[model samples]
Target: MTVDLIAVVPRNSRGRGVQRYYDAQSECAFFVSEPSGQPELWHRYLDGARDVYRRFGVEQALEYDAVADGASTSLFFAALNADGDMVAGTRIQGPYTDARQAHALVEWAGRAGADDLRRMIADRIPYGVIEAKGAWVARDAAHRAELGAAISRTVLHGARLLGARYGLATVASFTVPRHEACGAMPAERIPAVPYPDERYRTVPLWWDTRGYSAFAEESQRFSTQAEQDALGLTAVRPLDARCGAGRAAESRRGHGR
Candidate 1:
């Protein structure tokens, strides 16, 4: 997860404002944003993640329905190459006012006797709670980097930037261990909700950032270097104020919540 902060820019070639990070360990580039101010880029990134989800046969995993209102309080995290092509990406949503955005979990809560999850979030993580969603990595790009760990770090880092204290994710049974290693707990009472036409089941997990020691020990992952040629070299460019304005047409078109 170690990367160097080589440059900080307001926008990339696609005109989307982002915080870029580079990792020399795998010679990979990382990009992240919290509800990107650039609407078009946000949509495009979401689309890319969605495309990958469909490939995995779980299009419903994409939370497009909730964010359709367009007031996306979501963060998009991506991994790319030096060329800047999106090799992998995912979305993180929330700090929700309530559990409404967690559609599936909320629907299944009562039946699973996990209605307390809402109370737990309210009591322990009332603010800055982020939901990890639509995680995907390109098959071809897997060899170059640890997409799961990389993106999980991206989500955690993005959450920290957004002032969130906790993270939640509902993922397939098989994907649970990877997240646990990054510091998350399997949320109790989250029933096996069938998705992608009942062939799949998803479970929910929650993580208290304070409880996770990985991020602390892995601090090197976010470190930057002055030299660009170093091995495991990486870079992080924070989003600039200028990039927040977005495109004039997009602003004019407006968006809903």
Candidate 2:
């Protein structure tokens, strides 16, 4: 049997017996193809994220303010229980614009080679951060662990899929603390958290890391050696194709997938 979440997937195959909102498939599960058009899924994702943005290191007021200013494309999603109860809500933004379809313009701009750290704002390009709102996991410690893993697989897969098609080289996010209550405010003076903390959420985000590279120049910067080590990030040389003329696009394309 297959389970579709938010229609981004048309059918995902798995075994029966609902646990933690996802059907068990002998411990192996997969998402079905996106049933609907991609644009609709993108909008649906953004709407869900907008519903609750404040608690997750994401500043609702700031994000909305950016939207009002001129936001474009964004990513949004929800995790649900077997009863279809919402377990968590979040959105990763792209760009914002008053025009209803301006999000596509933002995508074009990014693929055309715009500055990621600077141009990719909620108002001008796309929202950089992914925010979780009203998030919950099974109360049992064991169940919670599984819940995090599921989220990692799903979210990472979703983001990577999007980034690959768009020619995006990197992804940036704002995570919240792991153990803080779902509604906890971000700890920084900027009034947000970086991402879900390592304790509650997995220490290194187990998703997305496999697909895109950090922007390097402007990623969530770490000052201390400990912070650097914890994120498990390292610098590597550019791809071999980048050195040659005819293969730059192909090289980047291969790296993205």
Candidate 3:
């Protein structure tokens, strides 16, 4: 079938089945909404991001996009079958404002014996954690493998392109939530982070190939065709969203214990 990835705006997301699919999975979850069990997921992701930065000597930092602002995000696209259905999906948490460290990263790659690797990440590091957010295709044994490969490659290329465009880096660490059949896929040259458990092993389409900090204010979503065009790859976007109103009435928002 024809697989296409499109942006699902907030107002229009009402009937997109995103909420319904989430609800179904949330039935036995820790929270009535998304999984808040481990506030550490974000930490782990950032840690992983920074870990990649050390080699590049980039000033690594983390940005948390908690609210859905209709901006760019990681979402999957799977073609519908005979039955007018399109429930397969995937999502990764990042592109966390880190793209300005490529010059050094590219150099680092060259020093490491992979000039192509430097070039691959000179733009973006298709490296970030990914987990299958939703997928109706998992039920079918026949279509599962193809779908998995499609998704993994999709994720990889998205990260690569984004990294290249923004001068950022990323890692595709899939410490995903549950999905047994998905884990069966072979790990390509890219390394994999062990999944949490059966219930949490969400499918990881792929990881970012490269930095930890500095981002381009002009990041975009993972274009479905872009990934395919890259032959497999992975960026960050501007993240200056703010809601400043009557701040005097409140106080401040910064990092502190």
Candidate 4:
């Protein structure tokens, strides 16, 4: 559900001589950029995500292709604590040419024999789309709700900035509530389905980027100004200059699903 990025007033911080900004929604200081130039940082977060995936006995590791895809054409939205430790993060891939070439969708459909799913996505090709994947939070992070919300909006806003009409994700059942809070709904006719991976049972979902109104709806749910402020965020700003340059360079490198 399209998160309101402008809900929070952001403040800048200077630490370790590294430029950083505070994300009120996530309640953590962070830096958002591409993975290529930040290999160690990227892998550190990936390791955390991998650990989470392992605990569930689901997909425990990322394939080479997945890593290459991310390094070549994805943005990293990471949440960091005061010690500059990345506690949670997520990756987003493309404004793709078609469904067949997009990340995870094609293989997932093939595994599930979801030809109709593929066709539905192909039909919507005229409207640009992106896939959100590899989201994970450190085992010990405070304000988990706010961190999830922060990651959700970061990917949503990132997709919008790249001119995508929608953002897609294959999320685990447990994570559906968080996605719903961010305005993500089922991409399939059935809201949640058994994924081919019996371990995780992740379900496909998507959120509209064009003319979304959930921000207005969500804003009204809060009673006082303080409550509202706590849930607010400067949504799109994190994906500003530095983030753009990375994606722009990756886009120039090549285009893939």
lDDT of each: 0.56, 0.30, 0.28, 0.57
Candidate 1 displacement at residue 123 in angstroms: 2.5
Clashing pairs in 4: 1-182, 1-183, 1-184, 5-233, 5-235, 8-233, 101-257, 102-257
Q: Write the per-residue lDDT of candidate 2 for residues 21-121, one digit (tens) a residue.
A: 23242122222222122333333334444544444444442245454322332333345444333343333332223223322223223332223222322
Ranking by TM-score: 1, 4, 2, 3
What local lDDT does model 4 show for residue 80? 75
Worst 10 residues of 1 by lDDT: 248-257
Candidate achieving the largest TM-score: 1
By lDDT, is 3 or 4 better? Answer: 4
TM-score of 3: 0.30
Specify the poorest-scoring 10-residue window by lDDT in model 4.
Answer: 8-17
Error in Å for residue 43 of model 1:
4.0
Stretches of candidate 1 above 4 Å error?
1-17, 34-41, 63-70, 104-110, 214-257
- Model 4 regions more than 4 Å off: 1-21, 64-72, 110-113, 190-193, 215-257
Model 4 lDDT tens row, 1-257: 22233221123321121222456555676555566645555666677777776775655334434574355446666677655667788777787786876655543653553665576567667878787777877767877877776666655555665677677777777886776666566554433445535555566766655322332136322211222233243232221224455754343222212
* Cα misplacement distance, residue 198 of candidate 1 (Å): 2.0
